[model samples]
Target chain A: MDVAIKEFILAMVVLDAGKVQGGGCPVFHAENSQEQQKTSLYLARILDGVVHDLENGVLLICRH
Target chain B: MEKYLIAVIAGTVSGFVDRWLMLRSDYRYYPTYPHAYLTHLALGFIAAGLGAVAIPALAKPDYVAVTFLVLAAQQFRDIRNMERETLSNLEKTKLIPRGTDYIEGIARVFEARNYLVILTALLNSAVVYSLGWQYVFLSAPLCFLLSLRLMAGSHIGDIAKIEAGQLHFDGSILKVNDVVIKNVGLPAEREKILREGMGVIIKPIDDNARLTLDAPGQRMAIIHDAVSILGSKVDVGEPHFAPLARKQIDQGYLALFMLANEPDLEYLMEIIKRVPVLESTRGTTLSSLYGRKAAD
Candidate 1:
């Protein structure tokens, strides 16, 4: 059977560098909210994932 | 032998016609290809032939010919497997898939349809043989009507009430009424969704209908059907715009959210209502004594 990662966070885009810590997935820190949304959209498109907001300053790209 | 010939012809013709009637290529887009139609028609003809010959083989006391009917039944089972495999293979490429429950229901219907053809043939031939060839006029139409009636299955509209739901966002979380659909991180995407999105609430009429809607597979079917007809804005990598059906949990109703190319609420609601209630996911809770007692 073919296997692949799903329902897992592929990458993270954060507005505050201090808000996120080191994890298995790569985290990209944006200079501002505009930069943050752009980075999330780019990451989501590249990773073939979806951008989901955590309702904080963090945005996650997850494959589902 | 001459007497049996007319019976066989009458049975085979009626059965083949019954198969042809059932092989409709509707809005579902299944069996749309000529080759697919040809394959099913050929199988239906074979099934009909087998049913037609059964009575004559017994009358002739040809025990060996009677055993072939069992082989025909085995052949029909393989048709179900063939249908299941083909649909499952095709499922991978679909943006929104008809879930396993729906696929199984469809495959089972294909198998059952052949059996119905056989029954129609058997009835026709039996009538023709017992009462003379003149009875074919009466028996053939009766069998056709019977097969049609038997083929009719319940649609979503029969069990549930569908209406337009309020599509809005609470912060970044998209919702249909109070049911949470999904979270969108991109503000632009949220705006597009708010502008183009449509929502519908499926309210089950009873506990049985609620349980049917509760199934993930059944919900997937509803989404798939609606998207297929109304068209969706979802693409390969963009999962945010994917049509989704989520349960309200407490109330046992379903909230469907979708960004459709057409974006017509009335058409979307109509499509959802017409979705075939998957047989595998069909609930019979109300039929059980305990379930009826619990509801009271």
Candidate 2:
């Protein structure tokens, strides 16, 4: 696969991972104020996971 | 002015039909899909043209009346559909916001425009009835222009409200709530040759910072306006970083858009990853992230 194409797929795969795992975080659906706050924190964590992978260029593969 | 009137009629009818289709249970959130919105608008325009030509040939008044009735009835039927979905939770791409009551507001505007069109047509047609066919013909087109002007203005207003954070972009903000990275890039020698309003901002990796921000329209302009007024400061991150500010939503969502898409997505992300996410979220930066990369 071309370098760009490979990179594209990897990036897409990572995003899809976040979308699938997002599953409406507990804080995203929390009823109580505290639970809601916690849900927001959890949501942040999920986003962090997604962002970290994207920044590292983890999806890109270059031929050595 | 005549062409403008034609555009008005076309736009009004287009806006109404656009709203009608959008109000459907399966379709309320559809407009956020830029491709889908364009498709629907084309469809609406075709329907109006067909009605204008074919209806006059067939039953004349009844044809036009039925078209209005069908459009109006469809919108009304979708009111209950609105109750089924939590408007705030749904996010449709970057153009429209998720939490705001856009569907309802859009529907209300469409209905108001519909009545305006019908009322104007009726009054004009009635007055023209004693005159000549030319007069009645003129009436239909006239009402259309009025409706179009109103619809365009309303769309512009909706865009403004979104920027003000009076409308959408809430869900994304709630999710990626923190300010992670910031960077500012000055307009290089190349950008000086580019258009009047253009610049860039770069941020680090800990933030896919791009995927989060997309918003309604007018606010996008406000951000553009701010960038133009503040010069390099806009790019450096001065005012946009403000909580729920229009540019805040725009910048974040833009980063998200530039980050998530394929091909060109990498272009923006590369710049964002290299540059530091600046503190103030103001100042003008480089003209184009990837554009410069290609030249290099």
Give each model's whole-structure lDDT.
Answer: 0.90, 0.32
The DockQ score of candidate 2 comes to: 0.03
Q: Tens-digit lDDT track for model 1 on B16-129?
A: 999999898877789867989999999999999988988877888798998988876788889999999999999999989988998999899999999999988888888888
Model 1: how far is B12 from its true place, Å?
0.5
Give stretches of model 1 more than 4 Å off: none
On TM-score, the leading prediction is 1
Compose the digit string of candidate 2's lDDT tens values, residues A1-64: 2343221111122212333343222212333434433433343234322111223111211111
DockQ-based CAPRI category assigned to the predicted complex of candidate 2: incorrect
Per model, state how many residue pairs clash.
0, 33
DockQ of each: 0.85, 0.03
TM-score of each: 0.97, 0.31
